[model samples]
Target: MHAANVPTASPLRTILLCFIVAILEGLDLQAVGVVAPAMAATFQLDSAALGWVFSAGLIGLLPGAVFGGWLADRFGRKKVLIGAVILFGLFSLLTAYSASYEQLLAARLFTGLGMGAALPILIALSSEVASVGLRNMAVSLTYCGVPLGGAIAALIGLFSVSGDWRFVFYVGGVAPLLIAVLLMLWLPDSRAYRDQGLPLRDTSQALMGQGRGFSTLLLWCSCFCTLTILYMLLNWLPTLLIERGVSHLDSSVIQVLFNIGGVLGTLLAGRLMDKGRALMAVVLAYLGMFAALAALGMVEQLQGLYMAGMLAGACAVGGQLILYALAPRIYPAKVRATGVGAAVAVGRLGSMSGPMLAGKLLAAGAGMSGLLLAVSPLVAIAALSAATLLGRDK
Candidate 1:
């Protein structure tokens, strides 16, 4: 599986390293959401201002993903990933240290730049490292770290002393810096990338060559829609629950349940894909996502809200896993990271817009139910697009 001329590490080690990094990524990505109420209180931020705050980090992700993947293709995934980790770690700490709202936004932007860079490389490395028969499972296992991390962040929020949110950011920042050291010591370069050594392709050729253009568009559409709802909930769920008169502690618990469900859903999505049930995975993920979104708005009881939150997390995360698993297969090895990066960059656009859109909806007098129902149709679009990709992939 590896070239005689290139160094390689065990697939187990590579996947483990990737999983650890993913946990840190997940924690930071979801940290803002869990801490939103406290942070808003600190800065006297209205929902509209908070929306831009959420988007500032997402805006940074775009350039980071585009260029990070391009560099990894040249310098190697390990290096790019390590640098990205360090970059994000430093900036996340800055996020905690910021004395003003403007400083906070700047810190989150730079932190997202680093985080945005790490995700594509993590996906690329996991896909390239595992054997073909186990690729989906490998990627899924690696992705499980993300939700696990989010669960931890929710726990932090739940137990926070004196309503301080910066503490979660501190843990998020420190853990990644520690992990970056471990990655440098143990993580391996992609055996597939090292062995295949295919020539690089132009963006147009890499993503849209031959008759693949339409399918690529479909893939991007599904990814965009999937992330839009996922991040909207991740960033807004707690506030939504609190606004509906749920206690902060209950909101945190619900968020924890959501992440745990995400972990399970990510694993299930991968397993189904590996078993040649990709279509089933698509249907369950998106249709369930649509239903869960509506349920969240309608459910009044705490237990009902818990069920809805868990379902939403599961379906949304599962849908995202489907896209991450599909991206590497659509392009050749050498240009694989770049291709995946482009797809991820588009997804980040959805991620950025989700929070901002929710903010706008709230500003315009939409309740939580109104906001969620409005976005449910996008799940249908995602379902159709992903289903088409499966037929095309075969």
Candidate 2:
């Protein structure tokens, strides 16, 4: 019998490429937030129009994720990733030259489709390339590019010359365009997927087969709950702190601390996953999140608040990365991207809803304590979901 050829490329090399792609995705997505004021002024847009412009991009992401995953499975991950990078890059460049609000909105929507498509493929690729035991760590490490990209956007927004919102778009567009060329030359398709030659399956079957249907549901639920809490903290925690008498500067600083904690938590969780304790680790992580949220509700001092914010971020963001890490293991490589994509699509819904839900609760006269208390139990539910997966193994 002839021996089959195997790809000898280092998985770390692939992970590095995936990281760069993720960072570009982060920068492009975050650029809109920083430039919204300028976009509103240039297009003579009202708050309502601006809100729709923001929403147009997010709306695109839902379908893009689902479609992108399907494409990645059908065509191959590297091809889909390269195409997505170029798609977003071109539209982002178009965004830099948009002459009207409607034009910008359309461009942003297209750009978001590309951006959203790239994320799951990147996660899938990272998971595939990783050595067996280190897949969780590898995915967690590469996913850090997102926050790192956001931090870069904040820096550009702070330092860029006034009335130059377009500069960030230019950077966002150009960098990814260049990176796409590199991906074309250097990125490789998954060896397992390449060897299998599996035909495309129905999306439902891809996600809910081989005794994984219920586990998929549990993962979806965990993703929704954790993402809801994460986005709530991202959008509302500072506002809540400010309302509770924290200064604006301190509120912002706490947000930074929160991200720092998230990075730390990802690192810690990855190691835990390698130890064959992913389920227990994630459960405890969410339990810790509940405690952190409780502390945020009770703490009044600046020092105490700072500690609580970091811990909250550690649990929320770290837990999210853990979910990403777990997703690839639930399916064969042929359908891995689709599976992750569907989960992410669900999570994005929670992302959109979280801030709105928090706002409504606040408007309805929920105190910070009341809000935090309400959120705390949801993490427990998420933990219990992870436990369900654990039970199946036994």
Candidate 3:
């Protein structure tokens, strides 16, 4: 989005509109994992097969992020965002109405494509409107809607009738259509994007120009490693809990706790960054995730699992939110969306791999404890990368 006259619009409206989109996007994203059991029963899906189902949506995200960002830079954020929302909304409906396993996979893949595209724009739009100090907090507040939406998904599942898991998807599907209408009616085109001019810059130039290569690489690395574990937990926590003998209803409650925790953690992180303690926020997020991962594996009781779930949700999702906030500052307004989108696109690869890796290992009979513990090194790597990226001046 190139810059224009900065529109003279209230940032509150943009934040609220972006927040609503994040909520619906999140509901759709997290709905699948919550409904996994029902889909498993209906499709006779084994762990490995289920991994494929999870990855299918994520696979679409990679290209969606790249193209969506590219399109936004070329056209405009509002138009591309509207298109992306409609695409995902339509496919989410398909997911609800899917009658066969293949149909489900196809629907999820396309749904992911739309989601992937919309996310970068959300991050970009949220940041572009705020002052430097407020940008992180603003983005965090907006991004919290994702986990809030996840919590809503859990709630929908909790009250929904058995064998009618499609209800959650139905709600997720329709809400975006309605939100898209709201977006079209009230959401303003990004003023910051409008204020900037010249469309000659491309993704590579946006990311690598102005001596930004190393920091950009670190950002990608951090996002990739962090997102791998983040997504693994997001897509599999319910199933993993059940595998360890927790009841489905209990797992759903835990899922709700996880998402609620995410909302809290993300807000706290953004607040910390706005106060000039970004490095502190980074440390807390990664360390919390490390501890949470270990705890999830060792704790067997419902209370223990619930505690771990909240911790995981906070640290994992909050870590991602930090990256979303930081990515925009790395580039000028001319290519902010492209740079942020590229980083997110790289991170989506990690998201795609995390679920499949867990499923295959679990199918191969690896203990959950070992699997969770094995991720500690990855978390450490991400923490170091993120810290380095933070300390470096953009």
Candidate 4:
């Protein structure tokens, strides 16, 4: 039987399965961050070395996302997604067993590769299976798994704080294995895939169609800027607060509030996008992010900072959700996965660079105000791009 001909499951089960896969994928994304301090202490690695290790995983993610998208189009979303989960699970398990920094770094790179592929396929699947009125909501629900996974990692770290970073990986690896098994049993291929008959060659041509053109380059630039700013905050906000005299415990608490805001904003974006105002939502979100960051830099009061953190987190992360909501609409069904995957892949470059840039700025004695100001322009640029692209009907 043709791979695409595999029996499809109910849409409700498919969405649930996709959500589970998202949680599993998110666990892997946050696991490295949760264990980074422990890993550094254990290996006596310098900041530069640790940065390389972190970048390695992000570097792998770029190609992984693109390739995974192609595979989903060529094979089937369910098949590619299952493979991604299994690959990530196995590598995460190996990461726990690494005896040296290099080994752990390599494992993380491979794990990231698996993670890169998993998200686009899941996003495509969720969008495909959702009802017309519920598509954005469903997609947002799946994406919310990312912050949920981070929260889970933080909880695990809190409970297992006896220097056992390995347990963190153990949890990350095992959860995905369980989810993959369930996915194999329940997730179905996207109907868009069946209707489009999207072969591998078609996927490739679609990604390359507007290649080297002004519009394509602009889109890539927009994606890169959006992701860089988003990840930079995700990776460094808590530490930034601590540097500004907030206690570690307070910083962690603030991080929790930030994540909570992200969940609410994501859900709100879904509802707003469904109302046919995705561009407006993105623009408003960017403005909110700018105001929040500015407030964060200027405010010395803890209450003000906490409020700013919540607003910034919600707007910044929610803007990304809007981008994904618009992605499937921007490209044809035949190349939908490839287009989104390619955008995300390019965004990884920004993601990898954000932390490094922040480190360099810090080293150069750029205070919190300067650093925050530097990143604010990115949101403006993204907002303008969204405005310019607003006329294009999805």
TM-score of candidate 1 against the unseen true structure: 0.93
Across 30-104, the per-residue lDDT of candidate 3 in tens digits comes to 788778878899889997788688778888899999989888887889999999999899999999888888999
| Candidate 4 backbone clash number | 0
lDDT of 3 at 183: 82
Error of 1 at 194 (Å): 1.5
TM-score of 3: 0.93
What RMSD does model 2 have? Answer: 2.7
Rank ordering of all candidates by lDDT, starting from the highest = 1, 3, 2, 4
Off by over 4 Å in 2: 1-8, 158-163
What is each predicted model's overall lDDT from 0 to 1? Answer: 0.87, 0.82, 0.87, 0.79
- Which stretches in model 1 have alpha-carbon errors above 4 Å? 1-7, 37-50, 161-164, 198-201
Residues 170-270 of candidate 1 have per-residue lDDT tens digits of 87789889999888778777765666565474656867887778888988999899999998998889889999999988888889999999999999999
Estimate the TM-score of every prediction. 0.93, 0.91, 0.93, 0.93
RMSD, candidate 1, Å: 2.4
Candidate 2, poorest ten consecutive residues by summed lDDT: 1-10
What CA RMSD would you report for each candidate?
Answer: 2.4, 2.7, 2.4, 2.3
